[model samples]
Target chain A: MPEITYRDAVQKAIADEMRLDDSIVFFGEDVAKAGGVFKVTPGIYEEFGAERVRDTPISEQAIIGTALGAAITGLRPIAELMFADFIPVAMDQIVNQVAKYRFMSGGQFTVPLTIRAAQGGGGGFGTQHSQCAESWLMNFPGLKVVAPATPLDMYSLLRAAIRDDNPVVVLEHKYLYTLKGEVPADASPGSIGEAKVVREGADLTVVALQLMLHRALEVADKLADEGINLEVIDLRAVAPLDSETILRSVMKTNRLLMVEESPRQGGWGASVASMIADRGIYHLDAPIKRVNMENSLIAYSPVLEDEIIPNAGKIEKAVRDLLAED
Target chain B: MTTDSIARLDRDARLKALNTMTTIRLAEEEIQNLFMANLVRGTTHLAIGQEACSAGVAQALRPGDSMTCTYRGHGHALALGMTLRAMMAEMMGKASGACKGRGGSMHMTDQSIGLLGANAIVGAQLPIAMGAALTAQIKGSGAIAVVFFGDGATNIGVFHESLNMASVWKLPVLFICENNLYGEYSPVRATTPIDDLAERAAAYGMPGVIVDGQDIEAVYSATLAAAERARAGDGPSLLELKTYRYRGHSRADTGPYRAPGELDEWLKRDPIDLLLGRMIAAGEIDQAEYDEMRGAIEKAVVEAIEWAQAEPFPELEAADDYVYYPG
Candidate 1:
């Protein structure tokens, strides 16, 4: 096993794929000369040169739109959007053009393009800079949405996304860029629609994503002596959700707590909660609980940000309440 | 349009251009009739009066060149030599359609003919065309992608963004803006600064060309020059064709927003009439030949309609197919 940063894992995935196929290329705001804003793609420029690794203008629409067109004509393009919030600027291309082209073109074209964006609130960036756009992207059919929480997951899922014939959006959390973990020497490429049970238990099931997954695990570790056995499920790919895995856990544990960083309403957390009630309600012994942001904006101040964004305390409290109710 | 280009056209080339213009004109007219009779399932933006632009540019393109256009792109598709039967079937939502009934009029595509698509979203295909050109540039394919859009589409963010990026990257692309005086119902004057839409190309450090949409020869010359420049690695060019569409925007609304006698004024410069008159005056095509060509087109369109009508509807369960590969 080799310890690697999540940032390196993503860069390696792109670099490795580009080496395998000359048709693979990437371009975005600062991906070439300056690597990337978050330094996720730092050495890609020196390695791939300017032709394969390009630095585009400050036009998200053109970045994604050109990739869609290039993908149509025998090229695999990886478009890096600086931040997820800026996705709306290219919504027409992403939603209408990129998502529907496969179905609309009647399979005449396969979009082997990967759209990467850094999302989630942590760096005190304003509202425009930070946003988890999984829900909005998941709404569009013919799009594969995958958010990896660990370095290994980042490398493996990115490979899966690059190989998938459909258009894939890889949402990487801003906070997890530098997170270090032990990734196998040849990290096994992951399937996009699969989920992982990072920690096992039979008492309660806790489903979380990105930074929320870390918080759920932290709470699970602290509650071990308190007789709380928490089963932690990491939702790697939110779209084409690994529902069978979550449902199987719910059927055994009977209690579920879902955590998310986006706004409470219409967020991924709401979808998970609905999925449990819609299908797994019969096996539940307690009500499904969701610890989410209080339906408010992620403010700049550390105090206000901490209040809105869920944390280990919130997950622990939610788990205690779900257990005390019985 | 310079009369020199039309005069320079040899007899055969002149007749072929006229044939293309007439086919586009008749096809759009037939689509209108079909829509009125409820034979076509969805609405279509007719390119009746703007046939010259599609005919000229598409004819100018080499066999390897790529093209994409707006929703009002039946003329462009026909000009690219796509089978009228396939296009008609697509618009009618038949199983034998170009896209197998999944994409209606707005999203018609056939990669075999190098026609990427006719997108419904305004200005959406500009960047895609840029990408195609980029791919060609990277692969040294020596192919150029000509994207056809309208005046209204120019106001979109992607239009300007794509132009700037294409010019900056020196991608092999030609942008064709068919200024048909309106974006749907709103006249171009109200929506855009109509003085020199082509001048925007200068901002991106590329050449801007303005031509008469009613003049097929003028359009062919301008597009041929642009495509040549792009293939030579001189970068993209913007060509704004000043034309007009006689019909309203689409099938649903009867366009009543025109100025008094506006339709009549534009109708005088219809491309089909312009080409027919020029070719007839030059003895390249006689009255007898023109009548035979038009009669042949009419007969072919009837056969296409008959084929489409006889084609079975796609299976109901097939709607779920192709949402993803091997789904």
Candidate 2:
């Protein structure tokens, strides 16, 4: 096992894949000389040289569209849009062209493009920079979405996304970049739709994602001290969800709670709630609970941002309330 | 009168260009008739008055070169040597069409012929074209990529972004703006400030040229020059072909926005007539030879329509396929 920060794992995953496949190309604003705005792609330009690691203009449309063309033709392009909040600038290319090409070309083509962007609500990136837009993409059928909660997951999930011949979105949370974990050299998380049970328990299933998974585990530790065991499930992949794992957990504990940083409306949490309501409701003794970012623009102040989004205390309160009810 | 530049392609190539332009005209006319008869289920955007641009650009490209176009691109797909049967079937939404019946008139693509895909969005294909050029540049494939968009598409942000990207990276792409005077409903005079769209290329540090798109030889020569530059790694160029569309933008548009005599003025400069007039004047073909060529083109159009009419629809079971390559 090797310890690597989530950021280093991403750079390693890209380097490993690029080493194996020459068709892989990386580009975005300052992805080259600046080594990415978050320093996630440092030293890659020196290793791969100018031809493979390109620095593009601030045009999100061209970035996504150029990658779309390259992907469908022959190359596998990893495009970075510095922030998830800027996705709307290239939404036409992402939602209309990139997502529709394969289906519209009638299976004649595939856009093997991976667009990476950092998303979360904690940072003082304010309104323009802090947005988790994976929910908007989840509605589209042609795209595969994944958010890794650990360095190991980030490495394996990205490998799976690049290798898969589809338009996959690899969402990196800015808050989780510095978090480090021991990653096995041979770990392969398999596909973009698989889930992992981070902490198993029989009391209540607490499904979480991204940084919230860490928060749920901390709450699990605290709740354990109080004789309230919490089963923490990390939903590594957001789209093409691993419903079987979620359903099994709900059936066993007869209690389910989901937490996310996206706004409640039209977010991943709403979708999870809808899924359980559709199929897993009969297995749950208590009503399903979702702890999500409040439906408002994330405040510029760090204190206000924390209050709007979920924390360990909120998770504990929600779980205790669910257990305290009938 | 056969412009010496196009005549340089020789009599055989000149006839090929003339024949393609005529076939496109006949095909579009048939499409119009089909729409009237309630036969075609897809929306039709006739390139009736803009044939020379498509034919000329297609003629300049090598075998492996890639191309994309706007919704009004039946002429482009046909010029790139996509089978008439496949194109017509695609227009009619049949399984035997160019894209296996998935793409209709606004989205026809024939990969074997290097026709990437025709887009419905105004400037959506520009970045894709640049992407193709990026691939070619990286692989040293010696293949140039070209995108044929309308005058209106030049206003979209992607157009400027892609042009800048292609310019800085020196991507082997030719941004051909088929400036057909009117962009759907609004006239060019009413929309863009500059009369010539080519000059905008200067802002991106690329060579910009304007040609009388109604003149097939001028288009062929300018596109050949641009393609040569792109193939030689001189980067992308913008060519504004001042052409016109004789009909309304789409099948449903009657085009009342044009001046009362504007339609007649542009019709006189019909690209097919210009090419044919040149051929007759150059002693390449007399009236009898002209009649024979017309007959051949008409026959081809009829056969394509017949083939399309008999083709089957795509299987419904495979609707979800190809979204992820299934691999």
List, residue by residue over A193-259, the lDDT tens digit for candidate 1: 8889999998999999899999999999999878788999999887888899999999989999899
Q: Which stretches in model 1 have alpha-carbon errors above 4 Å?
A: B1-7
Error of 1 at B238 (Å): 0.4
lDDT of 2 at A248: 87
**Which segments of model 2 are wrong by more than 4 Å?**
B1-7
Per the 3 Å backbone cut-off, how many clashing residue pairs does candidate 2 have?
0
Candidate DockQ scores, in order: 0.75, 0.78
Per-prediction fnat: 0.76, 0.75
Please report the candidate that would top lDDT against the real structure: 2
Return the lDDT, model 2, position B239.
94
Local accuracy of candidate 2 as per-residue lDDT tens digits, B1-327: 124544355788889998889889888898899887888875789989999999999998899899989989899999999888988888788888887777788898877788889998889999999999999999999999999999999988999999999999999999999998888899988888989999999999999988889988888898988888999999999999999898888988989998999889988999988888888888887878878988988898899999899988888997776666777
- Please provide TM-scores, in order, for all candidate models, with all chains considered together: 0.98, 0.97
A106 Cα displacement, candidate 2 (Å): 1.2
> How well does candidate 1 match the true structure in TM-score terms?
0.98
